[model samples]
Target chain A: MEVLGIILAGVLVNNFVFMQYLGICPFLGVSKDFDMATGMSGAVIFVITVASTVTAALEQYVLKPLELEYLRTIVYILVIASFVQLVEIFMKKTLPGLYQALGIYLPLITTNCAVLGAAMLNVTKSYGVVLSTVSGFAGALGWSLAIIIFAGIRERWKLMDIPATLDGFPLALISTGLMSLAFLGFSGLFSNLVK
Target chain B: MGDRLLVTPSPHVKSTKTVQGIMLDVVIALCPAAIAGTVLFGFRSALIILVSVASAVASEALYQKAVKRQVSINDFSAVITGLLLALTLPPHVPLWIPAIGAAFAIVLVKQVFGGLGNNFLNPALAARAFLLAAWPLHMTQDWVNPMTYDAATSATPLAGFNATGQTAFTLKQMLLGQRPGSIGETCILALLLGGLYLIVRDIIDYRIPLGYLGTLAIGTWIFGKPGAFFQGDPLGAIFLGGAFIGAFFMATDYVTSPVTPRGRLYMGIGCGLITLVIRLWGGYPEGVTYAILFMNLVTPLIDKYVVPRYYGSGHDKMARKGGR
Candidate 1:
């Protein structure tokens, strides 16, 4: 039940982008077109899951034993950067078509705060490796769910005669705000999860 | 007379103002503040700024090349995002913080949104907001004191106001940037000078800043105590933190802000209201970061409803259509 709650909380009530406002750049930037948004979501899910797993191990094994906690931020960034590079190279060699589809957005995963944010939060919250991995997977699922929904709305929005001033980004932002408000209704569902 | 060519109907006239030119102008305008921050904060400031700008430009270039999209790193927008994120950060913030922020700003916010003209919010402000939420201590940890690193952890003027309901620095101290705060936020005069240069160069519209500040002053006066405007000094509040820097440079980002005059006014007013509310009641000390970001999120909506009447279009027709 606790595990289920954690998954539910991360996926809906405490959505990484809409409710918590963690990974908003990708939420807004990639959601313009559904296909691209889906690709970005897939990439984020993969990165978050893998990064969190590895970072948790590093924190538990290396940083704790050495008392080098202060170096976590620098080390995490380097690790993430290298990890993303490895993923890119691997994708290019083994999965050329998949790599071609997500090629442009792969390097983008390097700097995504969500990846680091998830890893950091895992350590900060003192979650066990299993829980952290669960959080990572759920967080990515939540982000993917939110962006795909947003993209669907935006596709329909293309037909509406939006005013000149709000035609592009402004309208998208407003919709996001409203979506946030809508998502707020789910807050009560996961109230009994984390604590 | 034998062969008069016909021009296609669209984007009627082309101006010399390319994305690259606008971005270059922004970089030039930000140079003064960048220099001031470095001079005051020491070598780490320059190093952090360099890393941020480089990371952003590199990410943008690499992403474009990988995706087969047009490479836009030369346009300097990514450079602007990097510098702005660096300026907003505490000088002592770990290198990775700025690096992460830059990546968030450029790859996630700017490039992923379709790049350049397509982003919905100012990338730097969005990244700052993310960092603030993710690491409140690191984001709010003040290290701007000039003399000693030990005493560098004091609250900023805004944080002072939020925590104890009292400002340690007087109006003059705060205005002159003598107070402890973010590196770029220390010198009000420097920020204004840079802002004025941008305005003069026509790099940014003056309406957004003016409207935002004006509304903020009025809102602070009304909500605050009788002398709060004069005593706490609303103008001081406006100048103290990232308000001016954010209002002029970050909030008025062309892609994120409104296009028409009226839309811009609404955008400014919305930001002012949000900032004031958060400052007075929210958990955070400084609200400019979230205020600008929240407004950036709503900019699209503001532009939608605040459109000017088309020539000869009936008001009723527009209203009926808008109501849908």
Candidate 2:
């Protein structure tokens, strides 16, 4: 039940993009088309899940034992970068279609900040390995969900005869703002459930 | 007729302004504040700013090169992002902090989103927000007075107001910028001078800054503190903290803010409301950064919904709908 609370909180109430404002670059950029958005989300989910588990284990077993916790940020960032590179190479070899869809976006995941932010957050908040993995997976899933929904809205929005100034990026930003406000409705759900 | 037929769909008329031009204008506009920061904080501040700007530009350039995309460092957008991020940071922050911030601002917030005009939020502001969240203690640690090197850190005027319910700096002190705050946000006079230059050069439209500051003034006049409401000069509120810097430069970033006049007005009003709310009630003292950033998230929506009516379009239908 407590783990469920963590998952729920990370996924919804404390969503990485809308609520916490992490990973907003991809949230806005890749979200123009639903198909691309889903691909990016899948990539983020895979990277975050693996990165979190590795970071948690490394922080707990290696850094803490060596008293080198201060180097966590540098270490976590490098790990995420290498991991993303590895994923890119592996996907290119084994899964060409998936690789093509996620081609440039794969490298982009290294600096997504959400991935690094989630890894660092896991260590900083002192979540155990299991909880850290769950939080990371949930956070990525939440980001994916938010961006996909936004993509759908933006696609529909293309039909409207938007004004001159507000036509492109401005309209998208305004829609995101409204979506953020709507997401605020879930703020207390986890807290309430925990009690 | 052949050439006309070959023209691309829409955006038929192009402005003289390119992203490079606008970004260069901003960098020029920020020169005054950067000089002021260097003078006030000494060589270290200048070094930090240069490092940040260089690192941001380098990171952006390298990222584009590595990805086999067009290298866009010449646009000067990365420099502006780095400068803005450095200006918002504490003068005494660790060397790695600014480097990290610059890299993030350029690579994560700017380039990864498709570079130049593609970024949805102000890269500098987003980097600052991230640093604030990740390292709150380091980011929030107040600096000793540059003149004294007093070893004892003191709260900023805004923070002082939040804690003790009294501002440390007098209105005059804040106006002259003798008070301690972020490097560039200290002197209202400097910010205003730079802002005026931008306005005069026609580098930026006045709608965003004017609307932002004007609405903030109105909101502060109404709800600033009990007596502050009546006694509080809205102009003072505008001058305090990074309100002026953000309103004029950061909030008006072409890529992140609304393009339409009506959308800009609505964006300004929203920023003002959020800033006032945060300053008055939220835990943070200076809300301008977050307020501007929060509003950046909404610029797309504001542009979509608050579009100006077509030239010569009748308001009768809209007016009747509103009445109903």
Candidate 3:
């Protein structure tokens, strides 16, 4: 039941992109096209999941023992960046088809704040390794859900006769604001079981 | 010969109907509800409506002038948005609530997306949701008893229903707008007349309303009771809240709903499902506002996948992928 709460909170009730305002860069950058957005979603899900598990393990095994809790952010960045590299190489050799679909987005995820944010959040929330992995995957799913829906809407901009200045990010950000306003309906709609 | 085959710009279907004419028809249809709301709630309701519509028109004009775009306030869509937003608010709110809401609707929701036809979300519904979030007490607690004109508490039928799963108001009272709710929401007869007017004039698709109400009725019947099934009052459920107004006016807006018939049906059903979930289990007493807004955002995706099969289209899967 508690696990269900975490998953539900991550995906809908407390979505990272819409609710927490994380990963706005890639969310706005690669969301102009639907397929590209999905590719980015796939990359985010993989990286955030792996990064969450590794960070949780490091927090438990290394940080607490050495009293280096303050170095956690720096250490998580290093872990995420190197893991993205390792995945890029390993996928190129073994899963070349996926590499073709997700390769262009993997490097972009190396510096993504959502992955790092997910790791830092796990530390603060005191989530163990397994729950942290689930939360990471769910948060990425929620982010992916938002961007895909946004990309679906943005694709229609081709059909519309928009203004000169409000063509790209200006319109995108406005739409995001309205969308988050609507998503606010979900905030107190359910119990805060995750906490 | 030249007269018979004139070379006019394309859109050659012969019709006197226009955007302006359709919007005028909507305002006309909304009159009965607006009047009933004013009569039931007193002059305060009328002032709110006027302020909302005026501010909405002003916002559109001012924004267009500031941005050097064509001022399209004469088209009357802003009036309709303002009327709808004001209608959904609790009666006797501060006049500025509707004013601010109207501006938010016109400027942020409608104009930012390049004006009336281009916006995907319903402007009025979005504004109402904004107001509800920004000022929960006024939006929820400002309701008054229909005739006595006093601030109502447990007298609000929807809240009573939400708390006890049972209603003290009779069906006739609920139907006659004798109870307390949002300004336009209390008078079922007036809203129905407006909806019938829209349907008769072909301003809205009938299937959208039918699907929305039908799904809500069935869901209410199936899950309305605490432990029993198929024991809920579908008629009371439809008449108690914004379901009537939402189904007829807001949910069926052509700009935000699907272009295809099948997609509109799905949109209505999706709205009904979400409304049921919220009313039954979620925190809010009414779910129509959020239900409609959520479907409005999903509408583009529905339009994408529910594309009508064109003539001579290939059956090949890869062909379809390449076509999109």
Q: What is the number of residue pairs that collide in model 3?
A: 0
* Candidates sorted by DockQ, best first: 3, 2, 1
Instruction: Compute the lDDT of residue B147 as modeled in candidate 2.
Output: 49
- For the candidates in turn, chain A alone yields TM-scores of 0.95, 0.94, 0.97
Candidate 3 root-mean-square deviation in Å: 4.8
lDDT by residue (B1-324, candidate 1, tens digit) is 101111112334555566667678888878877887777777788998999998888888988787677786666778999999898988788888888889877876666545666555678877787677667688778476743433475667676564343455777766677766676777777788888988887768888898888887777656644334433456656866788888888887886777677888887887887677667655456778767766665555565567666655797787889996
Q: State the displacement of the C-alpha of residue A9, model 2, in Å, after optimal TM-score superposition.
A: 12
**DockQ versus reference, model 1:** 0.03
What's the true lDDT of residue B192 in model 2? 83
Angstrom error at residue B231, model 3: 3.1
Residue B83: error of model 1 in Å? 0.4
Show the lowest summed lDDT stretch of 10 residues, model 1 chain A.
A181-190
Per-residue alpha-carbon lDDT of model 1 for A114-145, expressed as tens digits? 89988987887798788899888998899888
Lowest-sum lDDT 10-residue window in model 2 chain A: A156-165
Superior candidate under TM-score, 2 versus 3? 3
